[model samples]
Target chain A: MSLPAEERVVVTGWSCLTALGANTETSWSRLLNQEYARGPISCFPTDGCRVTEGAEVVLPELPWLPKKAESRLSRASRLALPAAREALQHAGLLDPAGRSKLGHLEMSLSTTATSMERIEAFVRQVWEGKSPIQQAGRVASYQAQQQVNDLQTFLGFSGPAAVVSNACAGGANSIGHAFDLIRAGLVDIVLTGGYDILCELVFCGFDSLQAMSPDRCRPFDVNRNGLMLGEGAAFLVLESESHARRRGVPILGVLAGYGHTTDTFHLTQPAPDGTPLEKAIRKALEQSATSPSELGYINAHGTGTPFNDRAEAQAFTRCLGANASGVRLSSTKAAIGHTLGAAGSIEAVLCLKTLQTGQIPPQLHTTDPEPLVANMLARPGALLEKNAALSVNLGFGGSNAALLFKTP
Target chain B: MNTPLSILSWGAVSPGGLGVEALENFQNWPTTVASEVADPARQHLVATIDASILPEKWRMRPRFRRASPISHYMIEAAAQALAPHPQIERNRLGLIYVSFIGCSVYSIRFYRQFQKDGRRFASPMLFPETVANSPLSHLAAELEIGGPVYSQIGDKSCWSSALRTAACWLHNGDAEQVLVIGAEEFEPHQLEAFRSMRWLAKPYTRPFAEGAGAVLLGKGPHSGRPSIVSLKDGFCFRSRNESRTAAERCLAEFAPNLPVLDSAVGWIRPVAIAALKGRTVHDGIPALAHEAFGASCAWDTIRAAQRLSIHPEERVLIPYWGLSQQIGAAALEGTP
Candidate 1:
């Protein structure tokens, strides 16, 4: 399954703004310390909901945005643009004009909620009769494309862009699409990532589903409850190995393979048997041509919900077989909360860091590991024999995505 | 260059009626329906589907009944496309669901309930459907498609992107067959927005109607199907000059010498016309302005398939300019 050198996609630059920190370095340090960033929700009122805590990103200001653009863009877009800008700068694509000149650059963004805060504001105005029906048109324009348009305007980019809205799997799906595009020689450079913001709409919705934990999320634990919501954004600069070599840029890690599958068994729940998740993991391993024994770490999609943790544990056992005992498994969601759409990308960046730094972050707050995952990380950090790792994300709509990465 | 893919089957649910036949019939004799918007002072003409026309099985399914109307439209359209090949392996099929705004009505309902009645009153049933991927998941569950399912959120130009993605999936062996669907359901907020934007014509114009369009794409030179000669997308044209440049570059690759059939809608028509200046291009094709918001691209592709089916020796270039800055163009060659 080895790909041609020209077709192999690698991550050259990456940036993440998670609840744990504003940048990758800070977040990595916090994770290393087993810090939990969950606190009482301040972004919106949670008077009637059982869930009161969340992992929120507190930024001083989006200095890169123009004053005029700030008023027009949504809060989610504000969070996303800075991360994208950082990624481009890290990749050396940013120029003196505050724009990237790389020809044929493409962008694919993923999100579960695109500017829901703006939509809620507009709707509130409409409900209060403060705004006319014509003014509500602004709400109509609050789709995922608005984020792309904002990024394009801010970066002065003129290329193809797409929005992948696959719930929590969006981040991984965006990166997967970028990999396929570059691997197929469709484009040389792609800026792909995911972002979401805390909003009343999603909060109340999750509350209704009873899918939120009252306390800090504890993944892979026997006493695990539901998930805690979080807000953040992450972006990666993915390019073909040949393209990276031509520009003499540093490669952070190789995006060896990706696999996407749907349960089709339920709309909001994973298949109890975990067959769908196992298939996705197997497909990713097969595509990357890496044996399960070679994988050093497994960033499980441990949402902390009882069903999700149990199902994912079953999947690990079924897919890894005997190698399950050797893999160091952990879930960053315990530290950062569930970023939903941005979870996969943020975790992927963490995987790249783990590969580069050889430090496996601990699975915070898990007192007792699920029996199925024989090698769940209970300590602070561990060294890896092989730098290859896997990050998995399962989202609403039974969407599952797995990404495989190795040290460059 | 890669080998072309075939359009094995297609289904559409348009304003005129249901199924691909309805789309074809409406193309010959167009009709319009009266629709009301949030601005109660006036009534805007729209092409809306009659839900009663959908098959009983779809309407009666428990999941379908609980799903949103937009989900129903996509499922019905996909059902039509899949009806032709019942023997195809469900696991080998992939689905790419494309839409501009997904289930706005449900989103509004969920949010409105939460705002009015507080968090405890929020509806769990509606929350899942509010996400853009809900419809794709429902369609997959109904069809039992376990392969890779993706939901692409964009305007008209998404059609080209969807097609390109479907082709990529085929080339990458992700799925043996892929169903590319573009769908939009009429909601009061969307109608209000379109009216406010002045995109809707007065008196419920022809060709512009609410509908869903679907096509089954597979690696080709298959029997009795037109081959997609070349598909290209990801052209961002914010201005006329940029549109012209992107169009010129795209045409140079897909159809430098062949006669083109332009299918751009709304503000993008001029850009497409400018790009095809001084070239052998056809422009009299009826616009699907009455179809649902995103249906124009799918309708145009269907029209391209129809034209190629008649003129097997010709290659037609279809250029798409979305309301957003996204631009896409495709070349389709007929086969006999």
Candidate 2:
């Protein structure tokens, strides 16, 4: 069945921070030139976290500091808050120097040891017989809403807020779900992105899954290892086109449409043949009302695992057929480690930047590509003289999602 | 664009309990214990599925299988819900699944294994299912459904909000049938963690009286019989107990003499209120709730399903609240 002919969803703003650089332009610029962002993960000592190496985003030393905030924010949130702040600025949803009406959404996996410390303290409190204070500490930390409560109390956002935690698809899923809130008029402006701090819980989880690459993730490459876990956040400001037009907001790209599905075949293994994934692409295409031929670029969910790249490749081949080669595709993970939940949004911002700049980012270390996607990867982030791009993401539990973006 | 929505057929395996029994046994459900998905392993099963039963797929190299029998409970619940619902074009139906705590047993297992000997016991296959949203995502894939599939993990209040989101999608012509599921499986340890954190009450039980419900929401009607009452409207409130007050607050303002089905929705929430409310209503079409089977996640949907045979004049208050302190209070109007 074809997509229902209806209102076109458009991208309004985008932002990202990755190993390629601290901003979308810088990241995509180097990405298009086939530069690799692989480096030793030094932000935290990766001593006991299993395998090493990742596309770790190098935080640029900010010369200026805002003197107002007094609370300690996790690194992932620090990355996300700024990117979201900037995205809203670009969309004119947030005044450059002031606050604005906005709904906030986030998709995250594990955060660092912040909660661990709190829980430990709570344990200590109970041991010391400070039961009431201990109870209070446990209540706040174990509560999922604490994150948003913290965000609201810190950023002063009075609008609607929701946190989505769907593993790898978290970021894109957040953006996709957030778009609905906007289209449905729940909110005029929204900030959708993802965050995950480098944490041992996550480290152990991935290690147990054997999904982590000992070396750099070589997505679509025959010699691929697994995935290099990365830490960072990405955000996008999505506004209704009518609102953007009236306010004359600077549109970065269109949020377009997204497709989400679960394979259900096995919770972890992708539908080895890619049936659900193929269906996901079709659904996304149908939702966006964009055609396979119109998609000029793709940010692949190339986690560099044996299963993911292969599954994604087969899914792409099924979705695009010969048109698959016509679209330039690359895995930003080659530059930045897979940000788990943040990968989708960060890559989305990069894809938007690619559309805005007309350059498809290049894939580095793509030797001996998977046969199915070999031809597709060879074109690695070629310029899209015409501007429509799609980002593909899949996560554990057989989730497969796709998003289409268009330049304004 | 409000695309026309066809109420595709629906199938469900919930604790008001199986097939037409769920609809037929709508009166004071005899027991508070929830009906669980029949365990396939323990039963002498005639394998009708021609497809090679890859049951072992759960233990794959990259294994991340949903633990706690509830994941599978939700799957069969969904399979049942879809089986009876209008078979919408597979291409257009979408799945929306929600839960409060995602798959915790795997995390529990992972932690125990690591604590035992980090490398010696790590099962790759058991790892991925440890994350939230895995079951919803997995169920869609397993169904081979080619529709827009999504999931949300919210506290009690978002239970109705999740439905509202599905309705909004339908209103926007996004899909035909939106599969809404709430499933949860508890690891004794996870509950232990909750207890340590004071999130739980005591030596906990599955609270089978609380969980297990799935619903297919679209524009159409059930095949054999007309609905007892079509769900009219629902709003979210703050807490389970607070939800009752929110419903009471709404119920107070409306015509007191009007026919209303007062049911307490939510898993393990405002527990004995149902019995108390049932006693208050006396013999009239008292109420329906998921208090029998431990709550698998859904709050109001489970309660709403119980009133399928109620009259059109009956107004159903489905107050589904969440752990996040958000409350949704909505009313379902029975129609001619």
Candidate 3:
């Protein structure tokens, strides 16, 4: 499904980073080779962390980022801005006039702890009910923390600045919301993206939930343990057709159609039935002009969790019909790790890259899968002749999202 | 501009008052004072009532046991608003909680822990709520609302943004109902500010106070209640004046008695003075409650409307201008 013809949002510029590469091209190349970013958790003091193995993203040691950024910037934003900067640079929308038309938008899940130690101090002092002011009085000495001033202030985001933070579907939700804003004649150009940084709090939470896999994340694999958490960001420059034509911006691809739906089933679990994902997929097609058969590749949320993969596989079959088995499917997490909040946005960048260069990133570590996802690991990043793909993301809140793309 | 949705049921907890009687007393009050969600402890926070025996209703579905008072007030108000519509299931409900700063204690805790343990140790229970959306996620999970959840941390307009988020869910037909909540207590910095001679010297001063508010948006089945007054077709305003214009346009049909709530340093009886201005309003008047909740966060707006349910046909609008002016207005359904 493409957007209601009148409201289709086109992708004019985009950039991203993951275990595969720090920049878009390098990352794409790494993905095709099935090079998994697994190694020691070198950046942080993982001696106290639960796991040692991670798809640790290698930074180029850019002078632009601060030494402390490894601790600050939440993995999501740090990953997001490069892509955003690249997209802006690509679309030639960095100038004064374009800035006005381009609105700033971000979908953030926990990429890093802005104040990595805020909670630990409270336990030391015992949460005294004496006014939060008093509590702060006791903990004031520990206040050497900083956070990005909500994308608007940090990036000088002028037009309609907003942050979307909805667990897994957040990035796609941000894109969908940006599409709404663009279609409704709000902003001509939309800098939309999502970011999340790896943090002990989020990691510990996942560990407690029994969702962390000891080895690399192998989505759809028969012996899947759980998910390996990763951190990164992705962003795309969205513009209306008229604006794109006027600026002569080289459209990377068109964000043909998308859909979002809430399962309303369980907080930590997807519905035993994949109705919500189906509804989102159907709506994405119905809202967009393209049919499911028109979709060349399918990026599965493929969290490697038993229920999610099963539900998602069934949902894919419902959408792709007889072509479900033929459609190219893979989970990039096999190379990178399950980057909770930033997964949606980063995958969007990956899908668009799939459109530009006709290649699919292999879902490494997935030699065998559950009966439902038998065909997911069959083909790695095999690019379809026509550049078009749909990426779906689901999260803890039973939130689901589907984003479609086509070559410009 | 999208016609702003008509507000149906609005409730608030501020220094001004709680239930119906307090709202009427507010209508004619001459001085402006911040509303108090609780009260300033005479001696390091002494408890007057047996909070232990007060049903402890929130404990049953507790997400964070040591959550700040602001979160406590938020849950109380949300529980009240959603309780009425029992048939409205929580599973499909969407929730949004917004604040410039959230339970600053938990934040302070996380920070202090980093200092003591060198960022190596953080309470896993508390870690989930440290993110801005923790409260929203906690609320949604408690209610088993497996729908879209969002949290925004910013100025006064956080509440309206959350409400706007809910309206999107409503417009998109994603959820059957959406709950929007906002609350924050004075941080340590402001608490120090309150202790200064400047705070003590306010001409019409009354010391520390708390305030908060909450509202719910449902698909339909509105029982003739004043609902979704307007759905203004535009983004929320940026500048204070721009916000005023947005407010004027959204509430154009329902002329509200706008009261200037002073968000400055030394506030007091004179602050109450701002609310007492006798303005002629067709539907209802704006009862400013700054003295009640001294920067209690956006919950003050909901409390303001809850305080306004007195006049049978009157509507209440609470506009807060801060870091960025976010005007939160609600049209309350007054019972005859």
Candidate 4:
């Protein structure tokens, strides 16, 4: 059943932090200019990692937060607070001082490895038979919910919160659940997004899996090797149409549809045929009552791995059918690397930008496009006016989620 | 938001035993055992589950062959919940796994190996399970479920939050039945952290426990079945006074006159005291079930459903006082 006019969800604000830039506008501009953010690891020594280059964020100074209070936050929360503040400020829901203007607002955030760096340090201390009292706060901040808690405590929103940790698709899943909450008339507004930071254990794990690109991330390219790890955060403000109108805020776009499905085929590997992802795409389109032909732009998951890119390309071809050749598609991972859990939401912010300003971000470093998506890749500075844009993510555990955004 | 959900079936793999019956009479099942602590003078009270409690058939399943204990508990509890309803379509069932500290055992194992060796020595197989959603993903893969599934991280009161999300899914016709599970596994680091925080109980103050609890919810009409009538949650608190105030406000808005299914473990918490003031409270489950962390509220919910099954005329209110952050309440009524 479709929601009533008053309960329909709309996006009022969005922000992202990526290696390319610190905010959505800068990231989008740098992305259009084809500036690659991949470089050698500097924050921590990449001693034995098979892959050394990564996309790490250079955080801006947050003088608003006390120095002592900020010290307690993990890197994930450190990246999230600024992005969340920018989103709220963009939506006119908060003042410049990082305080909430609304009475009650909920939150739905996602993360795969929440505060792993802190947990690693804590584990080392404990394993060494040393006193872990100093690291107790770090251990307590290890769960994925800790970031949400930090956001609530920082933003001063006293609404319900949920943290979705469905691997890479977590970002879209969090946004999707937020949309569902508003559409179901459970809550009027929600601040939804996802964040993840680079940690030694996770980076080494991907290297152990041989999923990292030794060279550069070349998604949808015929000679693509694997993905490059990145760290960042992205947030969006979604509210019911009635609530937006009541607050007198300008609507950026409409959160048209959300499709969440599982690919029980394999834990790490998606089904080679890409049927499950196709089903997710179809489900999203069905919810919005928008045909495949209506979709103007698509932000493909395109992790630059063999199985993921091939399966995602196949899913797009099958779902879009004839429209596949005409629809503009690109993978921003080629520029900023794959931000893991933040990929879906960061790409979502890009999709909304494309929906609003017809300037589709180009796929970087793809010398020879794969046969499947060769005709669909966008050119640099390509301007294609599209009313609707689709963003999809295929996570590590065969979770596929799609979010469709339409111009209001 | 106030959608009535029929409790199709329930399951548990608590310190008591394997099913809801084990929880219904958990007080007589076994007593809490003492586990060794870092201090030589005293020990910590623990209620851990044995691996043998799981069905032998699960061992042969390739999907669960290398799964962690938390995954096993989650799958076993969900299997039990779906056991009686053989005709329920797997593709139409949604799964939501809620946990506070999730899969810490596997995380510790993976990190330990990585620290011992080098970055290249990090086990790929173990790394994927380090994420909070790993157990739920394993359960979904094992059961071959193709519906919407999510892994929500929160304190004990998140069980009520999951119920609210499940209710939304049911209201939107996303699934015929939504299986909500709260699962946690034992890890020494967690115990040590608890000890350091002084939240750990010495003898019998408030024993710490780990296990899984699940309930299958649907919007279908089933006479005499226990159904959730109201859920008043999203009461975020910062301190004890705030928690008590939140609990009082939640109870007032949810079901002020219903018999309360209290979530107090053993101590007289400020939130519990506020909820227990002039109310018909059922504190037996928390007294016997111990504190399963994230699974605590699920246990309380399952016990409320069981109470409704026997006394169809009673309406039960469950007020949840989380370890931190939020407070909530769920109201359940049995149909005539």
Candidate 5:
């Protein structure tokens, strides 16, 4: 499963927009400071739902794009473009004059709610018998492809673009696909990421499932009830090592391995035993050629739900075995809440930052760690080992993904 | 670029009818292409499927009680494809589902409920089906496909991408056999959107259709199936002319010296026609239109495989272009 030197995919540039801040630096600082971003939901009415708090990203106008283009973009696309632009610029690939270098570039985006707001508006029009099909089609941008299409048009990227829609695992799977494409030599560089925005559909959906926590999310805590929804986007500029070397860009980290699995047990619930998740973690480690003893930190899926946190905790013990107690584990979801489809990439950026700074942001809002994972849970302001780290994501339809990253 | 894979079995559920039999007897099937939209003035031809044709077992299954129409189409098509090889281990099977607009019916319902009745009325059942991966998940659960599964959301060229993923998975030893499905459901709103975008042709010459088609891919050559020669995909950003040029260049890169039977559909037809025009054009190649169905790639691939299966000496070339300027091409050769 190991890739050759020429085929090894490395992270050259990365950017993220989270509820805590607009950029990576600001978000990282806020995370380290243990600041909670959750607040009363204001984007839409949470009238009947018990849960009213969420981490909503306040979007700012992008001067880089034309006013018309900005106005036309869906909220999801608007959040994604800035993060992608920042990643490309960080990799020194954003210059319009150097667009030819992007001939082999590709883009993969992930999202659970792509323009749900616009779709809601369209639905309202249709329901009222005031349907303006043409204008609604232009305004709604309801199809998942429209997100990628908007990015392609805005960035002028000619390479293949696709959207992975596996709910919460969408982001991680998107990055995993990018890694595979690079390793298989299909493309030299890939702009891979995930984005999602706060909408009534998601908020009410989670509420109806009875899986939303009314209070702040507390990951790996005995009293953890349910997850709190959040919104944001994250992107990583992944390139084959040889391509990065040729371009002379700084390597932030190496995308060591990725593993994906599905739990056919249920459509919305994790398997109680966490067997599938453990297998996914083992697969990632096996593919990366890294031993459990070499692992430093784990960014748990840790949605703070009763099922997800417990299952993930058991998965850690089963996968890491003797090394489980020694590895630093925490869920940043406590600080930024759960970003849904964007959770994987956003957590991945945090993992890369942990590798760079040797600081593992603590699991915020959890004073009492769950008994099973207490020994592995990192406290506030804990220092991490400068080694390999693992980030995992689990989605609604039992889709699971684990990504392994290491300092170069 | 490496050795091609084989298409062991295939199935389809289109306006023509259900399963491979319907596809084979398509000519005799009634052509019911008309608008399903509420507005009479905005009428546009669309091919609709009859869900009543699905098997009782599939319809009565508890898992599919709340399933969307697209999911039903996909499950039925997949069942037909897997019917021939029940001995294949479920654990070694993978699923890759592609669509232009996924689960639009459920999406509209979910949004409408939220917009009208407020947040509390959002149905949890409808919410799960609203996601793009709903069909793929439903199919995997129904068939017990425990291996790697991926759901891709893209324009028309997504078929080539699905093929590429399946090939890679097989090549890398991830799955012994992969079922790739392209399914689309007929929704009134979607047709309205298509009409607004002018994607539907006027005068009802070629009607857009809704259906699902599937191809079961396995390693090496099968006794009676066609082997996939190559699959290539690319994105074009410059202009329409540049996109066509880029598509042609990519098509040329796949089996350049071989004589190809052009079966391109929709906007990609010009690219295939141009490639053939440069060389000597061949007669007897089928004239398929894009407006047949949203899963046109699946139909095109199935047709090409059938043709190549009969004519072993000829290679079938399939090219696709999306409204977003994404382009892709595939080559299939028959095994004697």
Candidate 6:
């Protein structure tokens, strides 16, 4: 699956902000220890809500961000700015020496809602007879690209930007699109990933669907009820291999292949047959020229919902055959609750970290695993040599995507 | 340089009316403007699409029964672009939905119910459409297109990004053809926001409008078709003062010598006009509807393609000055 040196895309740097911690290293360390981030929802009222537990991030202060425009920035942008800044800094793009390439850096980020929380507040104010004119900034930030705008303006990146809003699979879609851009030689560098913030509207919507777990997020567990919502942002600096080599920066991993497909079956529910998901997985493997046995780890979309986990497990079995049980599998959602739009990118960062550390993140808070996934689920914390890893995500509206990352 | 893409076909649902012919015959259509009191102190001028203009076949489809108006406009446009080419493999067709303000009508309605009925009684039906991708998924399902599908959100200039993405898809062999859609639904809150920001044009001067536009793109030089010659986007600006410079720079990087299809209106129109000074610029605002957000660019692109079709030896350039942050330009030429 390796492309020519000029076309090969590599991950140069990555950073994430999750409930487990404010940065990638902290989240990864806590994840290995099986430290779960679920707790009582504190960002907003959950008095009458069925599921009260969710993960919320406490962001660190970013002094470089202009203070005058702070109020106009959405919580999603606040979370994304620090992650992208760290990513750029890690990739050395923040240095004056590397600043010349900023204009060529295309941005592909994803989110379900940019500032839905602010939009809710704006609507309520309008209902209370408040002037819509006064709260107009909130409406401006409602578009998901507002976050991308914030990142680009703050970081001084003047690249063509795309904001994916494919619900849960958005993050992976953004990254996948970035890979496509690089492989097509449209841009040599890209700032990509996804971010979402927990809002009452989204939380209530899931609760109304009875898709929120009443107890805890237990992915692939026989007793699994549903998912717990969470908020965070993750970003990666992607560059063509030739660009990375010219810059002499460490190539974290090779983004070998990307496969995305749509399941036209339903808007909210994935097809139980998992045929579309299987197609997505097969496409990724075929594109990468990697066998199922070569995949060392799988970061499942396991939302702890019965429908999602079952379908995903079926897809793995259908696509991997006997190799399904051989590849170590886990859902980081067990540590940081289902981040919705941010899930795929967060897990992509986790997959790269997993390959780097050779540490498999365990499926936490589960007693009895579902029969379909029992054989492949990771047991506790285990270190093993890794070659390539897969991160798969299924979104609302039947958007299914799988990303394969290989060691460079 | 990116691979030049050929436009196989195009479609639109603009303030003028449904289908690209309406845009071609724009002078005959009356401007339907509504005065709205989005702010008690100020009256806003808005141009909304007539729902009755949607074809009965598209309007009555079971898949679109509960869908938002934006979805209806987008699907209708997509149908116009794809229906004629039934021979194209569905599995080899990709879709990209681009928008600035997504599904605001549904999102506002969903939140209103959530507020009035409390969180426990929130309606799940309206919540799904609140996400920008809802309509895109519907488009894929109704069209039975199983290829790669995505929803991209940005300003008017994002059209350039979507075009580039579609070109990449076509070039990668992921899909033989890619459908790019730019759509926006009329919503009161959106109007209120524009009015509050003083971005709305004077009534009848260049009012903000809503609608959808779509184009089917493929690789190679198809004779008699309009092909994208070059694209230069990502001219980021931090302020109004910087926008003119960005537009000029983007134009220079694109094809500065070609006749321009301008996608700028409202306060940013001057920036676009200044950048292409002395050039033969076709102001599409009069024909395609002014200040249509994402659709503004789409209409301009579709019009440029039409122009190229009629004038086979000519090349057209488009300069897009978005409401905020960025500028972009695209060049198109009719194939020999």
In terms of DockQ, the best-performing candidate is 6
Error of 4 at A353 (Å): 0.8
Model 1 achieves a DockQ score of: 0.54
lDDT of 6: 0.83
Once superposed on the true structure, which residue ranges of model 3 sit more than 4 Å away at CA? A1-5, A60-80, A96-157, A263-266, A289-291, A318-321, A385-388, B11-76, B82-94, B101-148, B167-177, B184-212, B218-298, B303-318, B322-336
Model 5 spans with C-alpha error above 4 angstroms: A1-7, A96-101, A131-140, B30-41, B201-205, B221-224, B237-243, B254-285, B288-294
Ranking by DockQ: 6, 4, 1, 5, 2, 3
Candidate 6: where is the Cα deviation over 4 Å?
A1-7, A64-72, A96-104, B27-42, B201-205, B283-287
Instruction: Score every model by TM-score.
Output: 0.94, 0.77, 0.74, 0.96, 0.93, 0.95
lDDT of 2 by residue, B47-107 (tens): 0111122234442323224344455656666766777544457667777766665565565
Q: Report model 6's TM-score to 2 decimal places.
A: 0.95
Per-residue alpha-carbon lDDT of candidate 4 for residues B1-336, written as tens digits (9 for 90 to 100)? 556899988999987789888776765655455542343234565677877878888877887888888998898889988998999999999999999888888888887897788877889889888767778888898887878999888777788888988998988878889999998888767766665545664442466677898899998447878998888677877655677677767777854567777567533265577567888775433445477777777788888888788788888887766766777778888887
Instruction: Give the distance in Å from residue B106's predicted Cα in candidate 2 to where it truly belongs.
Output: 2.1
Clashing pairs in 4: none
Better of 2 and 5 by DockQ: 5
lDDT tens digits, residues A185-281, model 6? 7777889989999998898889888999898889999899999899999999898999899999999899988999999988888999888999998
* lDDT (Cα, tens digit) per residue for candidate 3, span A1-408: 122346557888776777777778888887887788877766555555456667667654434445664344443345555656666666676655333234444322222233333333333334333344444422321221122332433344533334565677777877776776555554566677766666555665565456767776778887888787777777777878877888887777888777877665655678877988998888788767777667778888988887888888889887888766667888887778877667888898888888788888777787677776676453764657556788899876567889888888
Q: Cα miss at B170, model 5 (Å)?
A: 2.0
Which sections of candidate 1 miss by over 4 Å? A1-7, A130-137, B27-38, B196-198, B201-208, B239-262, B279-285, B289-291
Q: What's the lDDT for all of these models?
A: 0.80, 0.58, 0.57, 0.83, 0.79, 0.83
Q: Per-residue lDDT tens digits of candidate 3, residues B1-336?
A: 132343345444443444324433443423323322223432221111112422366665555365555655566656766777778767577777656545565655554564456433546555444554455545655566655566555445444445555665665556677777665554443433243223344354444444345677665434444444432222244433454454454444334464333332232234223333463333333333333231343444444444344444554444333233234433334333
- Candidate 6 CAPRI grade: medium
Question: Residue A269's C-alpha lDDT in candidate 5?
Answer: 81
Could you give candidate 4's per-residue lDDT for residues A37-61 as a string of tens digits?
9898776667887898899888767
* Model 5 per-residue lDDT tens digits across residues B1-336: 355889988888887788766665555555454553446566655567877878778778777889899989899889888999989998888888888777888877877777677677677778888877877877888888888888887677777878887877786667899999988887777665665455554332355677889999998887768998777786553444776677667666765555555445444455556756655333545555435434777877777777777787777667665654567777788888
Q: DockQ for all models, in order?
A: 0.54, 0.21, 0.18, 0.59, 0.49, 0.60
> Among all windows of ten consecutive residues in candidate 2 chain A, which has the lowest summed lDDT?
A105-114
Query: What DockQ would you assign to candidate 3?
Result: 0.18
Sorted by TM-score (best first), the order is 4, 6, 1, 5, 2, 3
Q: What is candidate 5's local distance difference test score?
A: 0.79
